[model samples]
Target chain A: MTDDATRGPDPAAMLAVAEEQQARALRLLEPDGAVIYGAWGVAWLVGPGLMWLSRAHDVLPIGVAGAVFAALLLGAGAVTAVHVGRRTQGVQGVSQQTGALHGWSWFLGFATLTAIMAATARAGASDDLLALLWTALSCLVVGVLYMAAGALWRDLVQYSIGVWILVIGAAGALAGVPTNQLLMSLAGGGVFLGAAALSRLRRRA
Target chain B: MTSGPTLNGLDPVIHAESRLRITATLAAVDRGDRLSFPRLQKLLDMTAGNLSTHLRRLEDAGYVEVTKTFEGRTPATYLALTDPGRVAFATYTAALRALLRPTDGGSA
Candidate 1:
């Protein structure tokens, strides 16, 4: 019988090792999904929750709630930026370009949406209409962007979350005022938190 | 009669098990990205001396690039696969697959 040394390394075994090592390297390139989703979950849950509480129970001034919401959103953005930056540090290539472009899409999309909403508000839209417009439009932007990201990465989970967010946005708009805020806080935040947990479990498995 | 596939197409530099693992790991990183020596050693679970030896061989073949720099007060070594290295690894894997295909009757 021919021994391993005489035959050289088994081609099949070598191929298996190659596949395993490549998988490990790819895993290293991904940012921590749980941390990213958890940050957004907290922001969505608490930010809109505060606003909903203020509107529904008059527990706090709407202005204060709005400020808190803005702060939380900014905080979530910061966390995402830091996490992604750390993961890609010292790496350069098409991935870096893709990430930069995706990040800009979020900023540009929101900026444009804000401009349109501001114009509506300036043109004598009622407080009720303005509130609905802001919530629905923001959700729409997030949903579309998430789907785009999912398509780019070919991640089913991300794409599913995007679809779910769109449903929440639509339902919240139909539900109307104060209640819409509550719906978004609970439904939108719940999905983010759930996604975070799922991501963690997936990694472990 | 059809002849069986041969392993002649495999790049000798990347055919060794240790070197194959190293090359595969580096190829997975995005082009122009560098992996630190300590990180690679930990990932591969190899001793410092052993990894250095394989790395030197790869470097000699122009399939790997090693850079030394100071991070803060400490010296650090980083490794990357050159363009030629990436091409070689790709060709090697393709050849490996082709060799296995006939033995497995193309089931893959």
Candidate 2:
């Protein structure tokens, strides 16, 4: 045990009424944690994965199948997020702060992604280069956000997911846009769904 | 000479565990909507009678406001932190910080 835990009860008990009460609120919060993360992940990553599969529709348009798959996965992800985020507990005080921070951080990432995409499109960048840049940068954003979320909540799993996304994103950049999208969709979606499932299981238990 | 920290600013009303949890929980919602009674009951692990009793105390102190609404004929009670309650919680925390801080830590 650390020094504080080992120490006998001191007169200066930190559990002053207000402090103790705040701690209770924090504990009850458990934070909005990974539900949102998983939801976005499944939606963003898995939808694209299906798109890649549909590109095999030689009988149809070149990417018709892929487009259909992406749309469906994206739809599913959105629905899942709404369903999961509907928590019985009103947001806890600590959670309120963190959720706001995390939500904004991701929003910033999306904004950045949009800016980069728009700039590249205006520049008339080649399709391949544009795709590569988008995938790489997107990966970095996802990774960093997950890391931030993990750090804020002191959850290693969340942090690891962030790290994993970074790796996938980085690796995809080198492998070209198609490969990058595929890897991100498969690995990223898996991670999101896995985390979501774990969260659900914990809540059930 | 400086006196040590005291509980003068501590809100005895909000200090109790259940009420504290309730207040903090209500305060946490960013949208400023009332928390349903069943939600509080589950979150705080309080029995219906116990939850209502503590809520009554907070209501009496003007720290919380409770309203009853019907969701398709099933009556529902929602609890929200009043303006005074928020102010009280803030004042309580400021006092708490002062008490927790070192009296002579300004070792410049």
Candidate 3:
């Protein structure tokens, strides 16, 4: 013990190192950042249901589902971009790159899914298969994005949420399309919205 | 392996504390990662004048790339590390590690 005290670095220098580490913590965003992602989740959750209802009943608004889909896409993107652009005014590297990746992956995934839906419809596949494919593809996009986000930011909660989506998607597929749609609404959208709320609460705390 | 931890290998250009911190911070991001000037200022918490001075030193070394652009009415300055800068930072880290390692024959 006596020998250690004589050889160790100065206490003041060590304190400075500790303080620097604390300041570095600010490099990470507050939980409110993730709350914006909840909007995307809500879109995923409700979009399928709206589509199903739109087809089932023609009495409702003419293009409600399609309109909602477009709205959610643009709306979520705008809101999240604004939130990130403002929140990340200073910490620009990781957050900025992650945002770009998130946007591109979602955009590409949605485009691919839309193409798949169109092709299947033209190919005369059963609606059940079409629904399953839709759910599966949607789930995959959510899962991959979540996992990528988690890996980039090193966030376990977001990563786990991705896993949850993958599992929910898989289970829904196995059970069939109707079940898958419900799960997308419940487990898929449900958990996202829930996590967003939780993030909000944590930020307040 | 000589007598003790070595400092002879450190790049003199980035040897100082503030500069080392700045380089390390920049290095943590990807090669092309551009950080807004205001953001970098906040991250380093140094006076704008002093920060600019240090940045100028690194710029002269060809280690940092700086860009100035207008975001609406405001001018935004973005900074990223050049390839040479990244290599220099990596070399600096290796040297620092070699310096901090124990001199005794125990494997670490």
Separate clash counts for every candidate: 0, 2, 1
Cα deviation at B61, candidate 1, in Å, is 4.6
Model 2 lDDT per residue over B3-108, tens place: 2233454666665556666676666554366677887777666789888888887898888888887879998888888888888777755665666668796643
Worst 10 residues of 2 chain A by lDDT: A1-10
Return the interface RMSD of model 1: 5.2
Candidate 2 per-residue lDDT, tens place, A26-139, comes to 445443435655666667665656545544233445266456655765675566445435653443343455556766787787888989899988999986787678778878
lDDT of each: 0.84, 0.67, 0.69
| TM-score, model 1 to reference | 0.75
Instruction: List the candidate 3 regions with Cα displacement exceeding 4 Å.
Output: A1-33, A49-63, A87-103, A125-129, A148-154, A197-205, B1-34, B42-47, B53-108
Error of 2 at A122 (Å): 2.1
Model 1: pairs clashing at backbone N, Cα or C within 3 Å: none
**Which has the greatest lDDT?**
1
The candidate maximizing DockQ is 1
**lDDT, model 1, position A45:** 94
lDDT leaderboard ranking: 1, 3, 2
Q: Candidate 2, B8: how far from true, in Å?
A: 28
Name the 10 consecutive residues with the lowest summed lDDT in model 1 chain A.
A1-10
Flag the better candidate by DockQ, 1 or 2.
1
Q: Model 3's DockQ?
A: 0.16
lDDT of 3 by residue, A117-154 (tens): 89989999886788788788778888888888898779
lDDT of 3 by residue, B1-108 (tens): 012232364555565556665676666555555777766777667678877877887898888998888889998888888898888877765655665668799686
